[model samples]
Target: MPSDTLNQFLNDNLNELKEQGLYNEIDVVEGANGPRIQIDGRDLVNLSSNNYLGLATDERLKEVAKDAVDSHGVGAGAVRTINGTLDLHVQLENKIAEFKGTEAAIAYQSGFNCNMAAISAVMDKNDAILSDALNHASIIDGCRLSKAKIIPFEHSDMDDLRQKAKEAKESGQYNKIMIITDGVFSMDGDVAKLPEIVEIAKEFDLITYVDDAHGSGVLGKGAGTVKHFGLQNEIDFQMGTLSKAIGVVGGYVAGKQNLIDWLKVRSRPFLFSTSLTPADVSATTKAIDLLMESTELQDRMWENGDYLKKGLKELGFDIGNSETPITPCIIGDEKTTQQFSKRLNEEGVYAKSIVFPTVPKGTGRVRNMPTAAHTKEMLDEALTIYEKVGKEMNII
Candidate 1:
């Protein structure tokens, strides 16, 4: 007594994925995702966490969470439009604005929700969005939800973007046009050409948007990509995740006062969804404060990235073109990449394989995330394992 259509579709999709060797099996981390992680009852050098700044387990952030829990209980009572906008929310937003060099800021429950809320709130069917081809899935969905004509410019292709923006303006295909891109490409770790992007935007009078989820805690001495390029005022939307480098949970948008004002009233997620809990909000504030305080974590993260990339490249393995700390050990076949990950797991390293759908087919790679928490000892051990596995798999 099964629903025939639903069951058939699910089974068909599952079978297809399995046949294509793309069916992913999930792994369990027994405890905290630290630099050294316990996976399936073994200690492994973890190189797959976005906890780049190691603030996820920082003592100061923990204390802030404890204090908030004691003072504000657990959850915000209701949605922001209802009874949920606590004084802490206002305080956190203010700190974020100051840190991001913006007139105002607003937080969302998650980074994905930030895109969902911000895009549709400002633009609609009458408008159009010029988005980068490799923009995050959240951004793509946000554009779709807005009912806007999504014009995907080539990835980091300035000439292509300029041509497309010019054509869109001339055709009068839609209303407002905004260009959105990730400040740093997460998988490849290459930075977006924001200076060129901004110049194009000014020429076309297009609104500039950058989702600096990966760049905030790493670039511009922790001020983020907009500040790195000295275009903080030129960009219209500065969206980011508190979860990544901030090492907390949530997202935000920093921009002009009027833009923030409009979003506060119009953004569906901000208005309808309940706000982040007191603990999360307060810890995030502490994270921003910490980043402003010192460059220790950012510096350590770069050291580790360079160390790992150098070691891997010396082993004669292809480490793709990466401008940031993200390191990918390129393995051309999906099944082989997964097998290599499995073999590395046996050798006490926990870098994960990224395959088709995340990247183009035949470009499968084992993506590594070297964080501030990783020590030279840990990285050396991981490098030793990578060398062994690369040779065993004939990948070097």
Candidate 2:
């Protein structure tokens, strides 16, 4: 039996969340998460996935993954330091390094783990991190785990970042100072001012770190945000996920050989957690290869994004300022945004609403991720549904 104390505590919090309209009910997809997905036996156009290049379900990646599984086993039997670092893992890291234009790279179980590992590995109580206000939760947690003083600047405000960097550097109260940001802000689809950030880092002599999870397969012709600005060598840490654009599962930090060596030696996750499976490593390697070979998938993804944004704007939706393929239709009120997303799902489009806490209180939105896999017909259908629902709900 469960402890009464634990049950009561959980029940009370859950009841409060339900009353505030903050409780989330997850919808389960019935099959592979692709351009279209089935939920509750209804087919719906999926605009909520991070498969920017449509490589998650690509046949070539599938074949490689299957072959790896047949040749190797399902799991990496031990922690990486204890012999779980398979040849496939090494190959994946090498591929990541080459693709990112870095001297070397290190892989972790997931993008989330990469943050926890890398941040804590290098930073400590004597260090300070100047972080962007809108960085991901993983980055926040990682910074905390480092036990370093965290200084947050206004989102994408170069002036604010420079001011904070100056204060931290001149104070001389910390051994090291690092500036961290999301290469692409996920909520608004607006890109980070990397050029300005690099300039600031250079002036302050601060180490630069970018979490390029959303930018990896969508920016820099699919190389990433660092390469987008041709600052691959300037940035100290280039962290990204294999799960998002790569269409696999894992994360990595690409940088100088010294940084990679230090992470391998000190990162707790790499030392304690088992490495990624052979299949995941092989598939990720192949995905990077495809990305390097051509930019067709990224081009298609951008085309879909442009079409969606134009259609929504024509229908009187306030799409935010997004330079990337990530489209957020701002709906203002939280309840309205949730209702809008619900209507979209009911009408055959599957876009999830991002409400308060995830974003600001009144700036709720329905985030649409246009992938390369979506067809023009599918997007057109989605636009029609949006118009119908927007008019019916008085949103347009």
Candidate 3:
């Protein structure tokens, strides 16, 4: 029933992607995604997941989720604007607000949804958004959805941002100007210069938005990059994901009560989409509780990250300038980078190759995500495999 034109387009593009080595073949994880994973019945040292705090598989979270399922059933039954808003959802929002040190918070189904909802909710055709060059795809897409004039400044170039802000403000072309950036650049693992950004926003009177998807539960003692720099009050939108470090399936924006109230009323996703299930809300609340209660997991996660980074760096791999636990082993050529990841898989490592569209054209890399669940022995084994493979491929 497919049209010939559509089939031709699909085939041509699929062939082009495969020929150019840009095609990403997703691997199936056979069990719970933890420090060690099983793919095709082969055990792998997992370094590709966003479960930063190891809470995804935590027994406490599992128990709470199961209890929620028993009590509330599986689904929310309808959209939030109807009768889908549950007490569990309210609790999760309140917990997120408390954990992030914000006056209030509103939850979304996912982090990507949060960006899509939040950005377009506040910004429109009359507004302008100053975005970082290397922000996440979701942020880029969200900005585009807002129909605002998107002015991209060089990655972390404060001077470029200030110049753009000055120009945008002085031109009087926009009714409102907003500066948006990732709290941590996910691909290269560099922390955003929030202190300088806040200063610029204050000077230009630009609304500040920080998408802290990667920074939440990783920095600021598990608070996030905003609280890491003590700028929770300064940033207008402190957006983050529960799926990353919080180890749940949702996202949220924590800020002033007025902003939260406005988002609840205006954000389309929160209004129209089916609400998060009781299990997810309950488990996410418990994750935030755990994060607020102790930093022991985060401490372990840091130690593991340092260990992996040191091992790779000592092996002469270009481990880019990462300020956090996310590590990217840069291997310039796309095919070679893919080959390196393929070899790693064969050797029991699961660090995936990030190429072209994910990063720059020639800066292909194998991004490693170390978590609190990874044992030192597992890392040592992975390092040994890296040594063997790097030598085999002359990548070292």
Residue 257 Cα positional deviation in candidate 1, in Å, after optimal superposition: 0.8
The parts of candidate 2 lying over 4 Å away from their true place are: none
Would you list the C-alpha lDDT of every candidate in the order shown? 0.93, 0.94, 0.95
Error of 3 at 132 (Å): 0.3
Residue pairs with backbone overlap in model 1: none
Candidate 2 lDDT tens digits, 227-329: 9999998999999999999998989999999999999999999998899998899999999999999999999999999999999999999998999989999
- Please, what is the TM-score per model? 0.98, 0.98, 0.99
Candidate 3's residue-wise lDDT over 45-162, tens digit each?
A: 9999999999999999999999999999999998887889988988988998899998999999999999999999999999999999999999999999999999999999999999
- Measured on C-alpha atoms, candidate 1 has an lDDT of 0.93
Per-residue error for 26 in candidate 1, Å, reads 1.5
How would you encode candidate 1's per-residue C-alpha lDDT over 1-396 as one tens digit per residue?
A: 889999999999999987876888889999887898897789999999999989998999999999999999899999998889999999999999999999999999999999999999999999889999988889999999999999998999999999999999999877799999999988788999999999999999999889999999999989899999999889999999999899989999999999999999999999888999999999999999989999999999999999999999999989989999999888989999889998999999998888888888998899999999999999999989999989988898
Clashing pairs in 3: none
